[model samples]
Target: MGMRLYAIVIYLFLYLPIGIIVLFSFNAGRHASDFHGFSVKWYGKVLSNPFAMDALTTSVTVAFITALLASVFGTMAALGLQQFKGRFRALFDAAIYIAIMIPGIVIGIATLIALVTAFGYLNPALAAAWPEWLGDAPRLKMGRVSLIAAHTMFTMALVIVIVRARLAGMDRTLIEASADLYATPMGTFWQVTLPQIFPAVLAGFLLSFTFSFDDFIIAFFVAGSETTLPIYVFSSIRRGVTPEINAIGTMVLAVSLSLLIVAQVMLRRRDRPAA
Candidate 1:
């Protein structure tokens, strides 16, 4: 009884704020705290707001691209690492885990410094090397490219972990049979290995998209002039909180929960016995 009570208390402590946000999202009042009556006008306002829409578009685009890149590169890395020997494999395993464990602030700062340094050197060199005919050489800077790159690098570790977990449980005999049957490696992967591991890859992609979409720390540093949904919300909150903010939070929460549920379902389905 004591443990149950404690658990309930802990859960409430964690979720009460989220519950409040969801509840107040429908508040008719202009203030976030004062709930005059239930209305969804705030949600409509949020959806119609041009700045918010632009930020949402940016977030969705970046998240989609980030997920795609992370899935592709991470899957490739996971497949390649299977062939690696002891120490090298262990080293890479540590690196992947460390990338995931590292704090977002550290990643954001490091990415910012790295991009700034690289751009400083590359922009000048590129301009110097450019032909006089082409008006001005394009310069590298912290923006969408950097944002996508940072997000991909961070989320790729998650993909590697998920895909590798799937790979570890895969039936090796199927692969052996494919090889014995004189199937090319590429052909075998396309027909056999890929089908088995695809679920995990997809789950990883969804998780990557969710993370990239919700992220503010890394995006804050590398976003340059671009604004993501999280960044926009953060900026908005600096002025004052309103029901619209609550509505935005509720919408983000809904999206994040939906994706998470889908990812969980995919993973569970992957674990089921063959029909």
Candidate 2:
């Protein structure tokens, strides 16, 4: 009975706030504070906010870029280090840990500085050759690109960790068997090794995507003028919580949660054996 009550207490503590927010999302009033008769007047407000929509678009673009870059780099790094053991291998592991375990503020500041410094260090030829879309210096200091880069930097270590674990779980016999079949290194990797890891790579992509989407701290520091959903919500709170905010929050919560669930379900199906 005590344990049951304890479990119940924990559940309420964790989910009660979510329940309140969700219940109040359809609120007729702007803030959840005073109960107005239930209606979705606020949900319509979320759609009508032009600034909010721009912020949302910018955030989504940045996060998409971040997820793509992180997945490619993380998966490649994991694959390269998978069959290795030695001093450098251990060093790489420690680096991954440091990347994640460091304070977010510190990382954000470092990233912001690095962006400026890197722009300075680029050769004139390199800078000239750079695509027109790639902004220079402090322009890099803020905006969609900055937010994406910040999120990617913060979430990269986690991606490496997940992909590495999945690789470690992979069957070594298949790799050996491919080699024994006289398949060339590149061919074996493409044909035999990659298929086994596709699910893991996909999982990492979704994980990184979700993290990049929801991040607030690094976004607060490195995000120039554009606001992500979390940042938007935070800023809105200063003006006092309105039902419009809750409506946006409810939509964000719905979309994010749905993606997560669908990703998990797909992963599970991928893992299961065919009859």
Candidate 3:
């Protein structure tokens, strides 16, 4: 009874603020401190706000691209690492964890500085190499491309970790059987390995999408002119929180929750025995 009560208390402590935010998102009044009765006016406002809509679109596009690129690169890296042994494998594994363990702020600052310096050096050469017809297309700088690269750098580690965990648990006998049947490396990967590890890849993609969508620190440093949803939300709060901001937060929370649920379902399905 005591343990149950403690667990309940812990859960409430963890989730009460989120509950309050969601509850007050529908508040009719502009003030978040007091509930001024329920209304969806704030949601309407969020949808109608052009800046907010633009930010949302930017965030979704970045997250989608980041997830896709990270999933492909990470899955490939995991497969390559799985074939290695001993010290090399251990060293690579440690590197992946280091990326995951590093603070986001540190990563953001380092990435920003690195991108600015690299672009400063490379942009001149890139311009020189460009065709006359292109007419000096804008060179890469700190913007959407930098943001996507930064997001993929960190999120790819997460994907690798998830897919590697799945791979570690996979049956080696299946691969051996495929080899015995004279399957090519590509054939074995596509026909035998991919289907088995696909659930982890999907889960990693969803997780990467969520991380990129909600990320603020790295995006803030690297985004330059482009405003992502999290950056917009932060700016709104800095200006002063409104009911519309609350409504946006609620919608974001809903999307994140839905993705989590879908990922969980996929994992469970993967774990289920074949009937």
Candidate 4:
């Protein structure tokens, strides 16, 4: 059928480049395109490359911290938003969706400008206020901390949306029964509410980690001196794409796919009907 053919074409269009990268990752030749034979020397080289390992370490650290902060804060925001009434709730709902819809480039540029402006003022003021004994007051700048904050701010919206969706489907009677039993609000949350929404939160955390790890646009602007895996890959590609780069891309793809699968499983578990 024409429709089936069209769908096949679309699928190939979307994934053919990725498939090429994976297939060529084992290329024995120095060139990525000319695959003389299959070998994983490139993978070994990537693993042994100190710069690549350092960048991977930074990416993992930033993504882990970002996921934790986003999950906690976003869950709290979702809970608090449940109390909003009418227009107020609509306004916030719009804002959260808008944050998710905004382009990564816009966020990166805005974050870069905001950090630069804040540092400009805060650095001078801190210097003026510092005691003479503490040789040189530390100044704020874009780096790992800034990267984490930007990633957390962007990913928190994802967690809020996921948790809120789960909360909407939750059994209200369970919460009501807990309240009727004279349980404290915190007790009700821990016992009755958290148990239901925890899967969504975990899924959100995994998704957030994946996004932060794979991100390049936002990290490119705000990373300062801190290099992430994506940034390193980008830098490498500027020179030329080699088998080493292909191997790195393949590994990144594998990790991203694994996280996505786990997140999907968590979401599926949450959506499963009560046994």
Candidate 5:
């Protein structure tokens, strides 16, 4: 009974703020401190706000591309690591964890500097090589492309971890059987390996999408002129919080929680024993 009470207290402590945000999202009052009444005006306000809409669109686009790229490349990476043996593999595994554990600000700064330096050199080289149309073309500096790359850099580590966990628990006999049947590497992967680990891939994709969508620190550094949803929200806060902001927060929380719940359900189902 004591433990149950403690667990209840912990859950309330964790979710109380979220509950307040959701509850007050519908509050007719503009002031966050008071709830004058219940209304959906705030939702309409959020929908009608051009800045919010544009930011939402940009965030969705980035998250979609990030998820797709992370899923494909991360799965490939997991497969490579699974087959690898030796000290290098151990080093690589440690590196993935380090990337995951690193602060977002550090990653953002490092990514920004690296991209700027690379583009600085590459732009000059390209201009020299092609003095015509290519020379005058705007060189890649920092913007959506850089933001996507930064997101992929960290999120890919998460994907690799998820897919690798799945791979580690997979049956090797099935792969051996495919090899015995004279299946090509590609054929075996498509037929035998992919289906087995697809749940983890899907989970990774969902997680990547969520991370990219809600990310603010890295996106702020690398976004250039583009404004993602999180960055927009942060900018809006300087002007003071309104019901519209609350509504947006509620919506973001809903989407993130929904994705997380779905991912958890998928993973649980994958782990369940078949009768």
Candidate 6:
């Protein structure tokens, strides 16, 4: 009974706000002042908004790129960390944890300065060298590119932690067996190592993608002028809550929740005893 109460309290705290958002999202009469009748008209308005669409497009592009980079790098880092067993293991692990724990705001500001500064350098260099596309295009914000890079920093840490955890529980004999079979080092990794880790990689990618997609704080920091869906929703709140924003919010929430659920389902399938 005590644990049940604790669970109920936690669930309520976590999901009550979402319940409210989902409720108000369907509220009719087109007023944030109070609840009205239920209608889907707000959803229709959201679909028609070009600005919201653009923000979503930008977010998707950034999320995909961030997820891909982080998954790849994190997997490599995980494998390398596993190979290392010494007093220095803690040091490397600590570094990864530090990156994970650092505030998003700090990461964002640092990324913005680095991006702008790099562009400042590249802009002049390209002008002197190619005197072509880079010169005419004039890369400043690089919009989605900057956002992706910044997001990857956090996502990479997430991937590393997840992949390392998966690796820790894995059977070590397969790797040794492949080595004993005289398979080349590269072959062992590609054939033996990578297959075991692929699910984790996919999980990391999806997890990173959803997290980055829903993220507003870090994105806001490094996003420059390229607005994301979260940023768009935030910007719209000041003007008053439109049903359109509610519709968009509902979609975002649904997508994130769905991806998370799917990832968990896949993990559970792998955990089942073989027939």
How far in Å is the alpha carbon of 58 misplaced in model 5?
1.0
Cα lDDT listed for each candidate: 0.93, 0.78, 0.90, 0.93, 0.91, 0.83
* Candidate 2 local lDDT, residue 256: 78
lDDT of 4 by residue, 79-147 (tens): 999888899898988888878999999999999999999999999999999998999999899999999
The residue pairs in collision within model 4 are: none
lDDT of 6 by residue, 19-95 (tens): 87788889897775588888888887777889988998988998888999999998999988876877789898787
Instruction: Compare candidates 1 and 6 on lDDT and give the better one.
Output: 1
Q: Across residues 201-222, which tens digit of lDDT does each residue of candidate 1 receive?
A: 9999999999999999999999
- Give all TM-scores, in the order shown: 0.94, 0.85, 0.93, 0.94, 0.93, 0.87
Q: For candidate 1, give the lDDT of residue 204.
A: 96
Between the candidate structures 2 and 5, which one is better when assessed by TM-score?
5
Which regions of candidate 6 deviate over 4 angstroms? 2-6, 85-92, 132-137, 267-275
> Each candidate: RMSD to true structure?
1.7, 3.8, 1.8, 1.7, 1.8, 2.7
The parts of candidate 1 lying over 4 Å away from their true place are 1-9
Output the better candidate (4/6) by TM-score.
4
> lDDT tens string, model 3, 54-101?
999999999999999999999999999867999999898888888899
Report lDDT (Cα) of residue 102, candidate 5: 95
Clashes of 6: 0
Over 1-275, each residue of candidate 2 has an lDDT whose tens digit, in order, gives 99999999999999898888888987776557777888977777788898778778866777789888888888888888867799999998898888889988888888778876775566565767778787862323456776776777656777788777767767788889989999999999899777877776777777788888788888887886677877888999998877777777777788778878866865674466422
Worst lDDT run of 10 residues, candidate 3, spans: 266-275
Report how far off residue 220 is in candidate 3 (Å): 1.2
Q: Considering summed lDDT, which 10 consecutive residues are worst modelled in model 6?
A: 266-275
